[model samples]
Target: MNPIQQFVRWEAEKPEAIFLQQPLAGVWKKWTYRQAGQEIRSMATALAERGLPPRSRVGILSKNCAHWIMADLAIWMAGHISVPLYPTFTGNTIAQILEHSETKILFVGKLDTWEDQKAGIPTGVACIGFSTYLKTPFPAWEDLVTTHPPLKEFASWTADELATLKYTSGTTGNPKGVMLNFGAFQFVMKEGLNAIDVKPGDNNRLFSYLPLSHVAERSLVEMTALYSASTIYFSESLETFGANLAEAQPTIFLAVPRIWAKFREKILEAMPQPKLDKLLKIPLVNLLVKRAIKKKLGLAKCKWVISGAAPVAPELLRWFQKLDIIIRDTYGMTENLAFSHINLNKVKIGTVGHVWPGIQWRLSEQGELQMKHPGLMMGYYKDEALTNTVLTNDGYLKTGDKGEVDREGFFTITGRIKDQFKTDKGKFVDPTPIEMQLLQNPDIDQACVVGMGIPQPIALINLSAAGKSKSKDAIRDSIAQTLEHVNPSLESYEKLEAAVIMQRDWTVENGMLTPSMKLKRNELEKANLEKYPVWYKMKTAVVWE
Candidate 1:
């Protein structure tokens, strides 16, 4: 059954059961299945009254919230296609997507940057804001729901019908709208749940904080909750994220690599790594230490702790494993709804893991990974020519990633084919591996290896909070040690000439990072390209920007 049908079944079977929990101020406001169903139905009815054409594109611009999911369901119930925009998108991007998708109406919910983003909503398109978030000039959701009766008859869709347009994060260029159908959701939800062994139960708790526009969070958290009849908890704000997570103690958790690193930094701040290691060596003390740490991170009850969106450092994975927190690494893309590969019970430290069921994969001559699956997107919206470049005639999606498979069928993403840069020495350098090595240093938060026309590659790094707190001499020593350790393992052409410490951090607000926290390599290069030659010629192994 599709997610909408499954949601309806749960609403009928367990009307009083709590399905969503949203935190306001310090307290959590909850919605039972029946209450949520009523809101969805009422909103659906209100949408139908707007005289929009059939299958109209409706936009959702909000962070993860109960209203966001309700709005999506309401759009689907009203026989419209849902288009989700990342909460962190800039005004220009937001306007571009709304105009490109030809969105009829947009549901604006909780956002930290609403003031700047509001201008992006085109004048012709109507908007409705969630009562709890912003007080916009447009109509409010509460008013609409109170005025309209619940939609008695929900819209039914065929498996092949288009459901939602999930736009890409746009690391390299303008974001493309991925056309996902009901069948794609059905395939991924069914196979994905079975693969992860998730059982339907109200007791199963999930935390939804990542951008739901991203395929990983949409499929894993939102769709998984609907299929499994799980209770989902929403984070209040960034300031209270830790407390909210500890309160929820979700059974399933998903985070990108950067988040995992931040979590590590937080733990280390409370208890130094040396002391942690010393305590873990004790027999009974180790168990208590592990339990306490897990409880603090709100993963004490997490059955499946997953890391995706970008390649996680194996060093970080091994560090967590020592505390009995085994974080599974997953690999996939927006085009496939993130149904490519995942580490199940047995995990290979560096590799993403075995290929997921019903996925066929092969490597191109240039080492680009290609995969064909039933869950693949219909194609990019309004850009058939661009879509044809990625989706081959043979039905395989050119992943734009270079990867290798081990004998046991485990997969390791080597680098992005587009990210490879040629040096002045006439050698192509893959920056991903070198950047991954740079990340092994706890002092480094973000790393980008760029050479371009330089004689040799030089790494540009942003210091972590811990690194920033330390003395410059100490930070330099630590980074030098890491380079010393990593350089020996690299080929002569790929060896780094120096490490340049960036004066500023790369953040989503700065446009150096995508909303998913992956580096916008192209943007990073554009900002720092002119400094490469000077940095490469530095006498010191580590150069301060």
Candidate 2:
């Protein structure tokens, strides 16, 4: 069944059970299943009354909140396709996506940069803003809900009917909309639950903080919660994320690599790694220390802690494993509904575990991983030519990631085929592995290895919060030590000549990071291409840019 149907079933099964918990002004607000259903139905009626054509594209521009999910449901119930825009998108990007998707109505809610983004909304398109988050000039959601009655005749969707347009975080060019059907959602939800073996129950709790615009959060958190009849808690802001997560104590938790790094830094700040190591060596103290650490991180009750969106360092995973927190690394993309391979019970340290059932995968001559799955997107929206380039004639989705499969079928993504660059010496450098190594150093928060025309590759790095707190000499020494440790393991050409500390952090607002926290390599290169030569020629092992 589709997610809306699942929601309907739960609303009928347990009307009073809390389905969503949203925080505003440090106060927690709740929505029972019945209450949530009423709001969604009212909004659907409002949309239907607008006289839009069937399957019209409706956009949701907001951070993760209860209303974001409700808006998505309302769009579906109104016989419209949901188009989610990243809350971090700039005005230009917002305009591009809205125009490209032909969004009929936009739901503006809970945004920090709405002022900067409002100019992108076309005058012709109508808007409805969440009253709690923003006081927009447009019609308020509360007003619409109060004026419109619950939609008596909800739109029914076939399995193959279009559901949503999930736009990719554009690393190279304009973001392309990935067209997903109701069947894709159903397939992933069923197979994902089966793989994780998490049962549907009221006790299942989920903390939604990640960008629900992304497929990983949409599929795993939003859809999973709907499918399982679980309660979802929303973070109020970045400042309250820790407290909110701790309170929720979700049964299933997922975070990107950057978040995991921040968590590690937080832990190490309280108790230095050296001291923590000494304490953990004690048999009696180890369990207590691990429990305390997990509790502080709000993952004490997590049945499955997953790390995805980008490749995580094995060293980072190993560090967490010391505290008895085993992070399962997963691999997937927007095209596949983020359902491909996941490390479940028996996780290989560096590998994203075996492929899920019903997925067929093979390697191309270029070592690119290709897979055919039921959860694959219908295609990129209104871009059939580009879609044809990725989806093979025989139906396999070209993953664009180069990977290796071990004897046991565990998959390790080596690098993105498109991300490789050639040096002046004509040697190809795969930056992913080198970047992964650099990230192992607690001092470095983000690293990008770049040398398109230089003799040897050099690393551009931003210091972690811990690293920033250290003296310049101390940070340099740490970076020098990391380079010394990582270079010998690489081929001579692949070895980084020097590490250049960035002047500023790479953030989504700056266009250096995707909303998912993956590095925008092309953007980084563009901003620092000319400096590559100067950085490479620096006499010192570490250069502060």
Candidate 3:
């Protein structure tokens, strides 16, 4: 069955169970499965009455909320494909996605910064603001629900019908819309629910903080609610994230690796060496410490804590372990609806989880990981050339990530094929694993290693808040010693020549990070080429900041 069918079933099974909990104006508001279903049906009737053609694109621009999911379901129920637009995307990017997908209806949420760009939306298309807090001159969201009765005479839907058209986070180039069918989404949701061991009617509370525009958060998260009947809470704002977490007390938690690192840093920063030592020394105090840590992270009640979107540091995993939190690292992409592999039972510290159930994986001679899954996208929307390049004749999707499966069938992602660089001797060097290791040091916030045409790999790192307070020489010494602990397993060529600490972070606005938070290596090299001489030639680690 497709996502909506499952959602419909859940509504029937648990009508009074809260499906969505939105934190608005410092208060938590709930929408039950029945209420959600009714709202979606009403909205669907309104859209159908407005004459949205079958398979017509219905785009949604917002963060994670009840309205976002409601609009998504309403579009699907109306026999239309839902296209989610990133809240942080530029007007040009949003316009490109809308035009590329030929979207005719848009549901805009509360975005104060995007008010001016609303005029850039296609002239003939319809746009509505869903949240009352939004001061836009656009029509209200309540109008959609109040205007029409539930569309009982709905058109038939098939597994082959297009369900969602998700655009990639434009990093390497222009974002392409990923066209997913009903079969693709159902397959992903099924496999994902199995891997995560989500039981229907289970008391799994999820906090919806990640942007729903991304398929990772949309499919794996929102769809799971249908399967698990979990209560999803939305965050008020970035500033209120911590407060929201404490309030949500979620049982299922998912976040990007950078956020996990920040959480670790927050705990360490709060209780430094002496205090930590004292806390650990007393057994009772240690128990209280662990509970306090969990409470602070809003993960005190978390039964399933999953981290993805980027490689998580093994050290961060151990830190979570100390607090009795089991963190499972998963690997997937937008093209596959983000359910490729999940490491849950057999936790591989340095690797992503085993290949997702019902998914087939193979590595090419060049070690590029390729996969075939029922959930894989049909093709890039209206881009046959790009589709042919990615989807092979055998139906295996080129993942671009270089990986290896161990004898036990556990998969270890080495690095991106595009990320691997050649040294002076023409030997390829993979730095992701090493970079992931360095990020675990608690003193290093972020690290990117570059060695193109150099004799050996060199690294540029951003120090953690604690490391920022240290003397340059002291920080350099600590990093060198940390490297010494991790370098024995590395090959001579893969070893670092020197490490330089960068003063600033590589952010999206600065063109150093992608929208998904992956480092833009080419951008970094271009921006820092002039400063390379001090590190590459010195043969010694130095902190530039």
Candidate 4:
């Protein structure tokens, strides 16, 4: 069933059960299943009255908020396509997506920085104010809800009906709209619920901090809540994220590697590494240490903790073992509605686990990962050529990722299709395998291997917050030792000459990192390309760049 129908079922099954808890005005606001259904129906009626044709593209731009979810369901309930626009997107990007998708009605919801992003809305496009920050000459959200009653009939969707258009984070090029049908979206929801063992009225609590624009969060937090009647707690802001998480004590916690590293660093900051190491070695004291760590991170009740969007360091996973948390890894993309492999029983640290059921998988002659999605995208909206390059003629979708299956069915992502580089010595190298080794160091938060025209590959390293405070000598020593150990396993072309420690973070605001938490390698290289010469001149194994 579609998410809206699922919501209707949940409302009927348990009307009074808490469906969503949204923190606002320094207070926790709530919505029961029945109340949420009412809001969704009201908004759907309002949109339908606006005379939008069936399958009309409508956009929602905001951070994670209750209105965003309501607006999304309403759009679906109104027989329209919900297009989620990232709040972190530039004005230019917002304009490009809205114009290209033929979206005219944009619902502006709970955004912290609307002033900077509002200019992107084209003159022809209209706006609906759905947030406290949306103070402009626009129709109020409450007006629509109060004036329009619930639509008499909810539009039922078939398997092939267009559901939503997902815009990619554009790591390599312009963001392409990923066209997903109701079949693909519902398939993800059903398979994902099965994978997590979520049943109706299961009491699986979720913390929503990741952007809903991304499919992972949309499914895990929003769609899962509808499918399983799970309660969701929203994070207020960056400053209150910790407190909100602590309040929620989520059952299933999924975090990006960047946030995971930050949590580790913050824990280490309060309790020094030396002290933590010493405390964990003590027999009974280790239990208290683990409890304390989990308590601090609000993961004490986390039955399943997952890391995705990038390769998680094995060292980080091992570090969590001292605290008794086994982080599972997952692999998927927007094109497939983010439904693919999920590490369940057998947790592989470095490898993304077995192929998801019902999804046929194979490797090309070039070792690129390919899968026959049960309900994959029809194609990239308005970009058939681009879609053809990724989706095969035989129903298998080309993942553009290089990987090999193990003796078991598990797959380990080795590198990207365009990730290989040629050295001055004329040998081609894929840095992903080498970078994964370097990232195992607890001191390095992120590592990118780049050296297209240089003699040897240069490792661009971003120090963890804890690593930044350490003396340069110690940091350099740690990396130097790591490199010395890693080079033997790598080919000559893949060996790093030096590690260039970045002084600044690679963030989404700077366009070095995408909203989905994937690194923009090409953008990062261009932004820091000049620093390569400066770092090359430094005759040291590790130098601050």
Candidate 5:
């Protein structure tokens, strides 16, 4: 099945179906399947008219929008590879990705700021605007679609032909362009569609806000739409995410662990823990409580909810499940198409669920997960050495994640192999599990455990808003009490001795977290490790930073 061709099929089969929606000037603009198809075809024709040869690389730097998806399809239709850049990327990083991919043309779509993005567009590299901010000299999206007739036929890609060059979020190192072919996308999309039933006449809706540059969001929001014909809605901004989600009542909601944590915090804020616990125990009130909570959280219509991109605490999973909300944990990297293992019906809470039926996976001697699958990408763009380092000669992709697979086939990611640190005592410690345990406390929003050449590991805890609002003594007491409970359970080597309660938030702007919301351990270490000795010298269970 050609993933791109699905748009053509759907347009003919369901011409008037609502295909896309975007918030414009406090109102939602809608597009039918046929209309979307015509615009995509028109965009493709315009690119061809600009003298772009097939197999050329085109960059798309934009946030989640109807035009972003349309541009992606148009690039594929024109037989060129699409390279997607995160909207949050700096000008330098944007230039790096575009230059590295050898992008010949770019499609500028909906974004908050175009100054930095436009500055990154290399001289002589053409850019076409899809929104108002990107204007003047270059052609505009509305003008092209209205002026140029839709191409009657688009270039058909063979299964093995390249479709996109996906750039990794790069928590460990620099981002690498993962060359994904039509076959890789088709394999996972088909396998996923087969595994999960998109019940007919369900009128499914998809809410997409996460960076589509990430493979997880791309697979769930874009590729899933191709397979299921789900109507897609784009979030306006962080301020209106709640109202947007409520309006859509999306059947499928995909998010990262950070968003899920925020939702849990919001729910707790509305109904305090004690009150929620009491209300959940009543016989008839329990059902009403669950329904009311779901509606309040805008998940009343959700049938499939997935949390991925990084490991989520098992406690978070359990908390949601108590309300009859199922959040499936999935595992995949840009090396593959992000649909390797998924927690389906029979889920083991802490694990990332069973491997796909047709895929092959195993744990290496060092407990690193390796995959041999049809969904794997071709290689890194223009970096054979880098690709060789990750891809095995025998066809296995070294996942770099240290994990364990249970006899039941559930996979649990413990931490990144590089994240393991050796203490001065010569014992290795994986901080992810400890960090996850620390995050269970409502007071702590983010936690990082580091012990490089230190006697014992130390935790750096970033406080929640509520925690920040609390008195300093109260914050210290809460963290100390949490550590008191957590310390006794772990071995001496892995236990965190002293905790530093950080006043600052760990965010993308500060470089403590990747755009995908995964913690950047190296950056965190570089920024905070020198203070460890001072904290430990205080001889207190917790120290404020």
Candidate 6:
């Protein structure tokens, strides 16, 4: 059972099926299955001739494109391990990962701003530019076809051999490489295809906008393309995302919570509460309104839409359901190639859903979620000490998340154990649940709860559009009312003393967030700790500069 055989078999069976749609000369260009497989085979032979040994590290640096997927399959077919880099990563981050993984070859993807990172690639590493047009001076990815002939077959890899190295953005420290074996990648992708009800040549279209380095998009979205022979459409950038969505009319959609929230906001903004409420009062009108919203979002054709990598507000989930879009919340990590369990048949609004088949999980006595699965990483690359610490003697991988299982066996992630802090009163408070509640208020765009040595947890919020545009009196009254509504559900010490509304949004480059979109709690807490008194004793809403 070789994974690369999926490509070979499909190419032989459906040689003319469109496998990729990429932007070229301001138009979408199609690549058939045979064309893609032939390119991959040629590139594999070229990589072998260049002396990339079995399991040798090969890094890919590009936005989501057909070439990116082709390069990955080629590397795996050559019996080399792939190392994917995020398009948003800084040069230093790229350099650190390259050095850590000992990457021998770098495939430079197209980048508008982060292209300068190429300078940081070590002098000895061979480099090639991945582009559809072969414009770069360096060896173009397309030129590999001419440089070497297609091999009779791609190198066969066993189930136990290494396939890829995913360097996930760390929440606590520098990123560590999560080593995924061929067996793990194959099993996870197979399970995902079954879970999503994918079928061969089913008009399954994926809008490949999310970073390919992320497991949620890579395995669940791109890997499915290998089996179903689906056509993948790559978004050029954020500016063209809307147009791309309209053009693609994708059958499957996957997005983070932030993008989903933005789509929700756009619809609600177009129709205010009074008009929407009146529309909902009528039966057929309400149905039409829901269908219209779904059609406008270009999700009317989408059979399944998934959200993961962060918690989504339950209210937002319900809002989408009203529009006839079933939003499935999933939970997984790079260590597992992102397919652990998904909420498909059972739709639990707030929970992450039950563990999928072929994976076993148990919560530690301290409440940390631990799991051992065939899909679990071999270990962190070059970090044996840290790897040993996380992998127990029995081989179950310890996920840092603190979670709870219901009697029905569904899992709910409360917070990260490292993010949990004890208050000055010695009561432990988990911020994730509190923050989720705060975000539900509809007046807070982002919220983080923190207080290391304070009497109680303090909330720092970035105001929603309603809060920002309204008068101070109206906004404060709403927040006060919201706090009153959210407080009674919490324990005595878990209740917030007061809250501060911040003016600026927390972003990745500003040191406020990790690459995976998790808040840098330590950075946030320390930066605003000095202003605690001002926010804690507040009788009225105070806005920060």
Candidate 3 residue lDDT tens string, 1-545: 77777788888888998899888888888899999888899988888877766888989988777898888888888888889987777777778888888999899885646765675588777887885547556677787688779877555688877788889886577888888888887787777777667889677788887888877787657878766788888888888999999998988888988888778767878887678768877979899988988898898888778888899888788777777888999999988878788887878788887887898888899999888988889999888999999999999999899888888888889888888888887888888888977786878888998887568888899887778888877887899987787677789888877778886878765768766787878788888766665568776655464
Candidate 5: C-alpha lDDT: 0.85
Q: Would you list the C-alpha lDDT of every candidate in the order shown?
A: 0.92, 0.91, 0.82, 0.85, 0.85, 0.82
Which 10-residue window of candidate 3 scores lowest in summed lDDT? 110-119
Give candidate 4 regions above 4 Å deviation: 530-534
TM-score of 5: 0.97
Residue-by-residue lDDT tens digits, candidate 5, 1-545:
67677888788888898889998766998999899999999988988898877799998888888999999998888888899998877777888888898899988777766765578777878888875434546779888988888988888889888888988878867888899998988888777877877743557898889999989889888888887787999888789988888888889888888888889888888898899999999999999999988887779999888888888878889999999989999888889888678898787898999887688878899999898988898999899998899999999999888888888878888888888899889999989889888877878888989888678999988887668778988987899988998998899888888888886888887778888998888888888778777777788888888
Which ranges of candidate 1 are over 4 A from the true structure?
A: none
lDDT of 1 by residue, 1-545 (tens): 77779889999998888889999988899999899999999999999999999999999999999999999999999999999999999889999999999999999988889999988988899999997877887799989998999999888899888999999998899999999999999999888888888987637899999999999999998899899899999998899999999999999999999888999999999999899999999999999999999999999999999999998888899999999999999998899989998998689989999888888889999989999988999999999999999999999999999988889988888999999999999999999988888888878888999889798888999998889999999988999999899999999999988999999899999999999998999998888888888887776799999
| Full ranking by TM-score | 1, 2, 4, 5, 6, 3
Per-residue lDDT of candidate 2, residues 1-545 (tens digit): 99989999998998998899998888889999999999999999999999999999999999999999999999999899999999999888989999999998999999999899999998688999998888988898989998999997889999998899999997888899999999999998888888777676637888899999999999889998899989889999999999888888898899998899989888888999789989999998999999998998899999889888988888899999988888999988999999889887698988999898889999999899999988999999898999999999999999999989999989988999999999999999999988988888888888999988799999999998999999999998999999999999999999889999999999998989999998888899889999999988876799989
**TM-score for every candidate vs. truth?**
0.99, 0.98, 0.94, 0.97, 0.97, 0.95
Pairing residues by index, what is the TM-score of model 6?
Answer: 0.95
Candidate 4, run of 10 with poorest lDDT: 131-140
Task: List pairs with backbone clashes in candidate 4.
Answer: none
Clash counts for the predictions, in order? 0, 0, 1, 0, 0, 0
The per-prediction CA RMSD against the true structure, in angstroms, equals: 1.0, 1.1, 2.2, 1.5, 1.6, 2.1
Candidate 3, position 492, lDDT: 83
